[model samples]
Target: MSGTLGIDFGTSNSAAGISVDGTPQLIPLEGDELTMPTAVFFDFESKKMRVGAEASEALLRGDEGRYMRGLKSLLGTRLIRESRMLLGERLDFIDIIARFLHEVKTRAETATGETFTKALSGRPVRFHSEDDAKDAQALVDLKECYARAGFDDVAFMNEPEAAALANRDVMQSGDLGLIVDIGGGTSDFTLFRQKGAQDIDILGSYGVRIGGTDFDRRLSITRVMPQLGMGSPIRHAFGNDTHLAPNGIFNDLATWAKIPFLYGPDTIRAAKDLHKFAVHETRLARLVKVLEEELGHDLAFAVEAGKIMANTPDVENPVIRVGMLKRKAVLPLPAEMMTKKLSGLANQIGEAAEATLAEAQIAPDAVTHLIFVGGSSLMQVVENALTSRLPSAQVHRGAALTAIIDGLALGTTQAF
Candidate 1:
């Protein structure tokens, strides 16, 4: 029998959920995962593209040529076609979208043991669009793509509202709280009052197209590049914004990496590592640009040791790691250094909070507590920022980063 599923189509991470017996249970894929990379891998000659997160941050660091990511940013922007070309030649934007949607759908379908032909997916409240217009057309386009991908009907919900739904149970005091969702590529804020049961009255929501991925990239370019010197072409390899970058380069890179026969004897020996090399530690990318800034000779090829220290649980080692000169040069970013890169996004969160307050006719003190959600919200700096902004209230840390998507799935069977 067909069932309903919830999908969180995050810019960098995605998750799926569903309701069971009036309770929402997050369906795990591959490894009890709630969030997987919005990335795809492909072969120059292949039948279908490989999607879903199959590699780790360390894997991405050693290779970058064929890795595809940040497809969530393709909504209503001028970079639509440029964003989809990563799937292969002559592919439409919906083709790439359908490919990803299909993969996420398939995994959830398998885990739930029921085909999910209908879904409730989360979307940012405002998507940056062409000529200063909202990306309303993107939703229509996505609907068409969803239909083609075998979804009978797909409904949309404001991401924050979905997150608010996930937290409806604990809010017992009739308090108005702020839900801050700091995701991989965007942050969304919503104010809600628990109206008893599953219903939530959303006051006003706020969002910004900036998140953890931005921090990682900023650290890579601003801090990591300075050590390599400015005027490096390697810096040019990454697009200004992950979503705004040219898709041609990304597609071409993906095309080169995926070999037709992955299990064949003639497969690229470094097949898996190829993408990591480019995305995380492109030695050739480094060598190609080193000479421009007079660092070609002085600069040496290095592995991105602790490249993902930001994701690591241990305070002793950064989530991201880089080792240079045969372990002679190891540049590990400290917690403060990483936190500094996240300040701008936190500032944006503050602005969004104030804006929400202004619209709701409420003061800063009126916000009882700030409920922080998403993977990035767990950062100490982000936690402190919320604390400073609503010093009089508590910071609710019980909600998961997967709250929005989980609620979307929960909404599929129950009323939102």
Candidate 2:
């Protein structure tokens, strides 16, 4: 309890941990739940704000409000500095994220009966893989958020490296390990040499801006967009034949992080124009209905839920309920289709893992253990890709949701 706190401010979910009597334990943040959903809702009628699960519940309960998830994805993007009107006041995104982090700090202090001024926060290896300046800016923004959340000072640890530290005890000295961490916002890989129970040496690390949210978007585009006039036709201005509907709007709708930006007046007017000059006008009408009612997030949630369910072994056909639409409907997602849809993304992650080994000057067969961390690592596609690439190495699974925090907690005890 006297040590620094370890916080994993994740894209899909978040958790905080601390070392208690030499053992790492996750603090209960959401009424006995170890992790809380990263979501927020602003109710206009009540002029109130809700965070985590309560935020999602408020939106699902038919409240008049704006529901936002994937807030972490905004970091390093222009939207992070943008402001929006809420309850007659303009608010910045950074402050909104700080509010969520502050709630985490409050609950952890209450659970441990101790106050924390310093934190060891977990961060991806790269926020923007292709841009160096933006990646560095992401760290600055996160540090500013921690400051606003009432922390005196904070330090960061690479998420995959933290996962490595958490599992170091189980690995023998001289064992080469590979850590594959696929979370909601990014995929990270780390190569390390375990030197003993308490010592480890990192070799190389790589990360890409793709993860569970990206899978949700691809699934939405494959299954949901067709139903909402993606491939449908519109009347041509001069030619006798019709032309396909423009993909710009559908692409935005399929993306979870871009939903809020598509509700402006200009986008609505454009959709209306498409609806007017359309073959199969009903589908475009449904698209218009979604924009008019601000149901993009709702549909995104449904798609994400279905995608997760379909990844399970027992589930054959997962049904995605679209209750927000005028006529309630369900989309049945078959397992094969879901797997096929995500193969491309999974392959990219696999390639990143392979590249990590090469970057460290180690062969694929040299790795003694291939460790899987994070929630999205459980997907069949991801597993298949990893196992296929590292056939000789034994696979290990860390605590899917807590390994990063556990590592951070242990890190706080070290001199570095």
Candidate 3:
């Protein structure tokens, strides 16, 4: 409470903590809960904003409002700075993110009876892995967001490195460990050598712009989008020839960050035009209904839920409950099918981990432990991919949702 506050501002969830007498203690963001969903809702009736679980509740209850998630994925893009009208005010993504962070700061202060003026935040090793300029700008943007959130100064630590710190006890003295921290928008890795009970030597860190949301998007595209006329043929107005529907709308519909933007007038008109074509009118009609009724997020949430259920070992006949889109509409998502759809992405994560070890000039077998963190790390397919690559390493699990914040809270003692 006295020094720096630690914040894990993740794409799917967010948490805050601080060092209390040299021990990391998480602040309860919601009632008796340490972590909160990184979601926001603006109520049209009250003209008030809602954050975290309350926001999700408002969305689920079908309250008339705008709901947004995956805001973290927009940090490096121009859209983050573009203004939109919300609740009678012009606000950009930066302002929206800053407001979420400010809520965190306020809750932490209220919970601990201490104001936090400085912060130590967790960030992916690469916000935009393929674009260096965007990656650099992401950090700058995040810093400004922290400042706007009432933090006078803020420092950042790689998310996987933070997880490594939080799980230092998982490795023996002088043993090498690899931390695989997969979140909603990115997958990060950290290679480190355990030095002592409270010390470690970092070898290297790497990341890729792929994670759980990507899995959801893929599942939606292959399983759900087709039902909404993703690949249906569209007839030309004057000619007998027909072409497959454009992929852009379906792609955006599957993507979490792109859903909110698809509700605009131009996009709806495009969907209607696609619906007007002679090929498979029913499927395209569904697409038009989704746009006009603003049901993209509901579909996205259903897909995400289905993915989680499919990943669970005991669940059978898991299905995406899309009854909101239509009467008793459900998309079957068997575990094997989900695994097959996601195997490529899981392999990509494995490749990134191996690349990290290669960059550090270390052999795969040299790593004695594989510490898995982040919510997405719970997927069996991802674990299988990683374990197959490092067959000799022992696998361990860190606190999936809180490891980064725990480490950031511990790092606060030395951050300043």
Best by TM-score: 3
Q: Estimate each model's TM-score.
A: 0.75, 0.94, 0.98
Per-residue lDDT tens digits for candidate 3, residues 291-405, read: 9989999999999999999999999799999897689989899999999999999999999999999999999988899999999999999999999999999999989999999
Poorest 10 consecutive residues of model 2 by lDDT? 407-416
For every candidate in turn, the CA RMSD to the true structure comes to 8.7, 1.9, 0.9
lDDT of 1 by residue, 1-416 (tens): 23777888877677888877767788786577777877665543443466665633322443332434666666665445443234346665566777788888898888777888788888877654123354676677667767867888888888888888788866665788888887766677888886766567889987776666555555555455444322222223346422222222222221211111122232223322222334344443432233222221122112122324553556685533333322455567777776777678677767776777788887888888688888778766667767787887767875656788767866887533
lDDT tens digits, residue span 108-127, model 2: 89988888888899999988
Model 3, C-alpha of 107: deviation from truth (Å)? 0.7
Question: lDDT of candidate 1 vs native?
Answer: 0.61
- Of the two candidates 2 and 3, the one with more favorable TM-score, higher being better, is 3
**Per lDDT, what order, best first?**
3, 2, 1
Give the TM-score comparing model 3 with the true structure, all chains together: 0.98
